[model samples]
Target chain A: MPGVLDLVGIFVFAVSGALAAVQKRLDVVGMVVLAEITALGGGILRDLVIGAVPPVAFTSVSYVVVPLLASALVFFWHPHFTRIMPAVMLFDAAGLGLFCVTGAIKALDYHLSPLHAVLLGVITAVGGGILRDMMSGQIPSVLYDRQLYALPALVGATVATALWQQPQLHGVFVSAGSALLAFGLRVAAMRWNWRTPRARGVGD
Target chain B: MPGVLDLVGIFVFAVSGALAAVQKRLDVVGMVVLAEITALGGGILRDLVIGAVPPVAFTSVSYVVVPLLASALVFFWHPHFTRIMPAVMLFDAAGLGLFCVTGAIKALDYHLSPLHAVLLGVITAVGGGILRDMMSGQIPSVLYDRQLYALPALVGATVATALWQQPQLHGVFVSAGSALLAFGLRVAAMRWNWRTPRARGVGD
Candidate 1:
């Protein structure tokens, strides 16, 4: 079930890229490249760290084709995606949460400490988004000095890791709770315009 | 002395990428991105693997500017770069060798095992070139059915790892010898068309 929901997260991220591409007035090739990077870059980074060759997305036929098709659809038909932006957000939150958990698991698999695992989880969740922004010549999300997107993933994954000793209790509930928590935090931040205090100084 | 060589390597790589950009007919923006990535990508990958943040390239102003200037030069003057192609290849080999040594030393600094450090060195040597190839939609050198490029880095760094265990030999000739071996191997391979035999049958 958790694995299935990860697909939804990938789709959500793809839609975000497609929208960004449209807004940028990009060609079809540009739209596909952005969508693939946004959806796949994080997992690729995570897997590479753990020494997973080809990464799962590269080997998995479903993961490879789905994003491309979605990009094409969005490229040709924007009206449909316009109505479903909210749904994409929900699923994307779920993806962020699930990917965060997966990152921690992979890091721990590499024998990293809890703190290190938590950091890796945060990176895995947000790395793709940052890459997408960089390729598009926009400021990365992390550079914006935004509130809690990465921090919440870090917290949620650490919490899950804390509870990981109960092997039987580890599957579905942890995934759901993490997804919900990340979603809630993101929604609250969006509504309230919450932000981390910027590094402030006058002109140097 | 080697610090200067490393920067020279960075310039060679940046120029190699910029020249590829010209050959590929990329725009100025594309050329800059390719050059910077070729110059910085391998080190960034090495740092991330060792759990270092921001990567050295981000923090180093000279590292950043040299690649940008290289790309700009290539964009404006196609004829000069073409004439200097042979010199660039020699420098590119030297740079590849230097990156391998630096990567191995860093991995050792992070307390990785000799085996892992050698692997890291190979990655550092070949990773940027392969990534540059991938972004340009070409087959990566690592995936090429060709002479030992990355493999020699693996071998040379392994020798460095063993030689460094001799307290008297640490940091003197061992490092330089390994780098020279890798560079010499590359030059030999290019000159003689030396190659690893294909593992699979060549395509019909």
Candidate 2:
């Protein structure tokens, strides 16, 4: 069940990635690469740190196929889909929540500390977006004054860790609840235009 | 003494990186970014994996100053330089040798096993180039038919390991000689156009 949801997270993240590529006006190849990384990047980092086998890129056909399809959609249908950013943003938030919970669970399975698992979960949620921004020549929005992006993942992972502490509580409720926490926080942040304050030490 | 050599290695590698950017007709900022990554990339990877705090990027002004100077060279005077490709190749090889040897020593200092140290050394040598290629949408040359690039690092690291097996043979000779072996083999491979053979099963 977790694995299936993880795939869904990857698929929607890829669609968001293709949307970013379209916004940036990249070539088809760049669009595919961006989408792949956005979908699989966090998972890959989590795997490498845990010394997992083959990497998801080689281990799962869905990982590749889903991103390719997403890329194709954005490339061929951008004219019709440009106004769908709101829907894409919503799905992206859901994907972030899904990846954060899954990544934390995976880290715990590897016998990492709860703290480390939470960190990994947060990385799994935000690392791909960071990488995407870096590749596309933008300051990672995570570093910008954007809304509470990474914070949502951190909060979600923390809740997941609390669930993990109770052996009986480790079920669909924890996953669903944690994901909702993240998605709701992010949507609120966006709607309210919440942002982190900048360091005032430097001048323009 | 070795630190000085590493600094020189950074300078040369930065030159190569800046030249690569120039060849691709990128602007100044791109040249600087590529140059900085080429110069400090291997060490950065090494530090990160070792759980070393304040990765070289965070602490060293030399790492910053040298790459900027290299980029300036390419930006201001590349038009006057001829046979840029060979210069880039030679410096790249030199940087590879320096990184391979230094990385092995660092791994040993961290008390890793011989095989593990050697693996780290190889990663330190080629990992940056692999990343740079990925960002630029190019297949890594090392993954292709290119001759024994990583193999040289393995051999050098192995030699250092053997030296460690006997306490009597220590100090500069063991380290420098191992480094020499790596450099010589890599240069020979480059000069001879050596390559891994392709095709498998029934030959086409």
Candidate 3:
């Protein structure tokens, strides 16, 4: 069973996905499908890459139920949700932070190298959003968005990886600190409108 | 090590993917990346779902090498390929047919039920194309294209699954027949412009 933090992360992510479906004018079925995909896609991708078969998403009933509940909530109260978009974005950052830390830890548990663990961590953080964008027929914002999204995840993953090397560190504290760093960075980036530089001479 | 037939399928799929990259005016690196993704994404998805660790695409040198060669070929000779787009489509059909059969057999090997095997088979045949279209920021053609694409893969996968239930049947012949059936259906659909009907009253 996933912890409360993980379930909260999945619920927020699922809500984001359901909102995207509504924005695209998709029907109820599409809302459910998108919500499930967004909530589970990243973890599934990480599990697949790390040779963890029967991914947790498939095996855990709570993982599936949380997404469904989120979808239902969005479906019934989406107009209210639109008014609270900022709050949703903040929650999304928390989800990203939590996913990056947990994903890295999971990869390390599977005996993957630190570098691979970090890479997988970042992937798990952003993959669901990428899938959500693509399914909606949009370019993944992470690839070209000026905002510092993936960079924050990368920083968090690196921090987790670095801390993981020290076995004596308290595991819960290490994870909490890394996730908090990522969440803080993401929130700051949004607040200050921080932007990554565009590639020179490419788009121009 | 994959057989010659599997290599051919990967090569053709890679060619199709590279051609898409060229059509979208992507760079050489993009071409290679798309080629690899299109060639190996389906099998990898199937492998991941069935608990096959470190999918063949990662484990086998041939799978990686074949797509790289195909990408290079398309990079230098794309104009010629554009002129022979019909031929490319036919080859793609062959790849679809081969992948569906092989994917189904692999699922059955992993002791998945016939229903799951059939589903995986179709996914393996179409997953790469969906990923390619998504990565390129387009709606997946298989989802909406007015052509018989995934249907043929379903037919092939169903056939393979049914035949696998009978151990006395010759493995080589059963696979060959199933693949040929799928290839023929796809060719006929293309020649006749067969299309699946859109949902009634949805778009309207």
Instruction: Pick the TM-score winner.
Output: 3
For each candidate, what TM-score against the reference? Answer: 0.57, 0.57, 0.61
Instruction: Write the residue-wise lDDT of candidate 3 on B25-128 in tens digits.
Output: 99999999999999999999898888987898999999999999999899899999989989989999999999999999998888777776876798799989
TM-score of chain A of each: 0.89, 0.93, 0.97
- Model 2 over residues B1-204: C-alpha lDDT tens digits? 887878878888778666666665544544665677677777778876875533554356676688888877666777644357676667667777878877877887788887878888887787777655544445666788558787777787788776866767768788788878888888888888776666676342
Point out where model 2 deviates above 4 Å: B1-44, B47-165, B168-204
lDDT of 1 at A102: 78
- Single out the weakest 10-residue window by summed lDDT for candidate 3 chain A: A24-33
What TM-score does the first chain of candidate 3 have? 0.97
**Displacement of the residue A84 alpha carbon in candidate 2, Å:** 1.4
Which stretches of candidate 3 lie above 4 Å from their native place?
A: A1-43, A49-51, A56-130, A139-204
Model 2 TM-score (2 dp): 0.57
Off by over 4 Å in 1: A1-204, B200-204
Q: Residues A48-149, candidate 3: write the lDDT tens digits.
A: 888776677756667878988998788778888889999999999999999999999999999999999999999999999898888889888899888999
Compared with the real two-chain complex, what DockQ does model 1 have?
0.04
- Please give the ranking of all candidate structures by TM-score, highest first, separated by commas: 3, 2, 1
Between the candidate structures 2 and 3, which one is better when assessed by lDDT? 3
**DockQ for every prediction shown:** 0.04, 0.04, 0.15
Candidate 2 chain A worst ten-residue window by lDDT: A195-204
